[model samples]
Target: MDATLWKNSSFLKLWLAQLTANIGDQCYSFALLWYLLQATKSGTALSLLAIPEMAAGLMFYLTGGVLADRYSPRLLMAGTDAARIVVVISVGVMASFGVGQFGFFLAAQFLLGVFSSLFQPARTVALKSILPLELLGRANGILDTTFRSIRILAPMTIGLLAGSVPLSALFFANAASYLVSVFFVLTIRDSLKGKGGSTASKLTLGQYKRDIATGASELRHTRDLFYILLFGNLGYLVWLVTYNVGFPFLAERMDQGNGSTLAMLMGFYGIGNLLGSLYMARACYTRHLLVVLIGWMMQAAGFLLLTGGPAFHWLAFLGAALAGVGGPLIGIPSVTAIQVKATDANVGKVYAINMLMYTCCGMLSSCLGALWLGKLPVERLFLVSGLALVLLTVVGLAVEKRNHTTKHHSLDL
Candidate 1:
């Protein structure tokens, strides 16, 4: 349980590939949302952007895991990256030509989501295949820290680039990053050979269904892991809506009333996220559920700080930083726990089930974000969600405390 994942060549290559692609993705998302903010002047539009993507992932994640188990993850990763290049480019072209239609973005998001649903489980399969059980936590921590660090800088770059460049250019950059990812992913040896692709062509629909069920069954049998993933992500679902939809609107109420201010505030959050992951990377987490609850507790405290009244920018920024610090606390441990607990034969499936739950929650959050933003002030939404999260975390803490005392299948790292 050491942070020595740097020595793993295959993981390094894949991490590099993901790193570049994530940078581009961060840029594209910022520009696209800013563009939509200007074009529609609606928080609903920004929130709606994720719904199609989540729905697509929800429908296909399990199947994608099945495919990953039966086929070559390298091929799946490379091919999906290549396909996303086309999909992202198309969105860029349409937007460049003055098509501000939300429906087009929705369609593009659906297509991109489909590609991602395939790529992600394959990525997990590749990661687990390459690394050992002990290194999984460190690997997750390093990866999360890097991704969060990107969140720190990418927005400022996007903010600087905002008036100077066309938003379509950001899209093009994302497409190119995917191309880069495809290159590195192609270079990774198909370690799942002899087991996976050897019989891929022979896989039938019945087997596909069975694979899905088997994954679900395995997840349920891994009781502690399954419940932890579920509750931890439920906390995140609220944060996703508040951050993505509420933050944009919150910026409008602030001093400059511009995207740059929002970018700066989010950058602070990224700074906090970076610090949290760095600590987790060096530490060993034996009780992942406790780690997740602690994250929720920090976030709850931050959210509760909102005077339950005015939307003060200073307070908002501080809360964002606190919430950011909590993210990796929740994310890294749960992912490592999943990887450590699941057998290799069904790891892809279990990971896909996790994604499926996340996507489903994401879809729900998208609707909630859009529906609620118009009905209530952004501050009120944050306050309420924060309160609910606090309640959930408290219940989880009580249950976990009882579970530990009872020794009800207590997981020891």
Candidate 2:
């Protein structure tokens, strides 16, 4: 658990590339939402932007996982980055010409999602291939911290600049970041070898499907891991619902200006994540599974505070900070566990399934939140969801502890 494990050149390149791309992503997202709001002024229109992306992600992620297992991850990373660059550049040009329709934007997002679905699984696997097992935790910690730090800066910067600059400018910047990411990925020497026996031998579609089924069955059998993954997905759902649906409405209720206050709050949350990641990096314990459970509890408490009453209004920032703490605790360790436990042969498939779970949760939460909008106050929704999360966490901890005790007793006998 040496912190210096993150000093590897390969890890550094990948981490830096991800950091740059994520910053651009944050900037583009805020700018895109602002443009849509100004153009349509309808919640439906704003929500539609998410649909194509989510559908594309859901449709392609499993296939992406299969491909990652079959091909060289370095090549996949480079190619996907290049594809994203083209898509972003096209969006920039179209917007600059005042010809960027909502449909066209949606298409861009969908295509980006397709490429991203492929890129992410490969990227995750590639990091494991590059870093040693012992350093995985530290590498993940650094990676998360870098991404969070960029998120902290990107939104506020984009919000400040969006009014002065055209949306096209943000798109152009995003495109450049992707191209830069490609360069950095290219510099990484580590490449993934196919785990499905010979790369020279091709599998039929049926064979491929069978392999995926086998992988799925293996995942289902790992009961503790499955529950942990489920909790991660549920945590993500709560986060998306609260942040995407609740926060915007709450900002409006508080009479915060469009985008500015939201940006500021996100920055604060990023600060919390940054600090939390740093703390995690120096952490000496190996009981990250338990840490994730505790983190969820902390998040639930934070949400409850947010939902409590007028007296808790002053704690909104604290709530955000606590939620931020929960994220890396869950996200970093959950990923590490999968990487550590999954056989190299099925790593891609496992990671893909994990990604699907989280993405589906996000989509479900957003859809549910959309339905709940205008039906109840945002604070009330937060209260309900927060309580639900607390209960879930408690149950999860109990199950985990029981499993631990049973295993210990079996070993003793």
* Model 1 misplaced stretches (Cα beyond 4 Å): 1-3, 30-47, 92-102, 158-167, 192-196, 245-265, 308-314, 366-383, 402-413
Model 2, stretches more than 4 Å misplaced? 1-3, 37-43, 159-166, 192-200, 252-265, 409-413
TM-scores for the candidates: 0.86, 0.90
lDDT tens digits by residue: candidate 1, 278-332: 9888777677888999888877766766433234667877887887788888878
Model 2 clash pairs?
none
* lDDT against true structure, model 2: 0.77
- List all candidate RMSDs to the true structure: 3.5, 2.8
> Which tens-of-lDDT digit does each residue in 217-253 have in candidate 2?
8689877567667776777776788877776676666
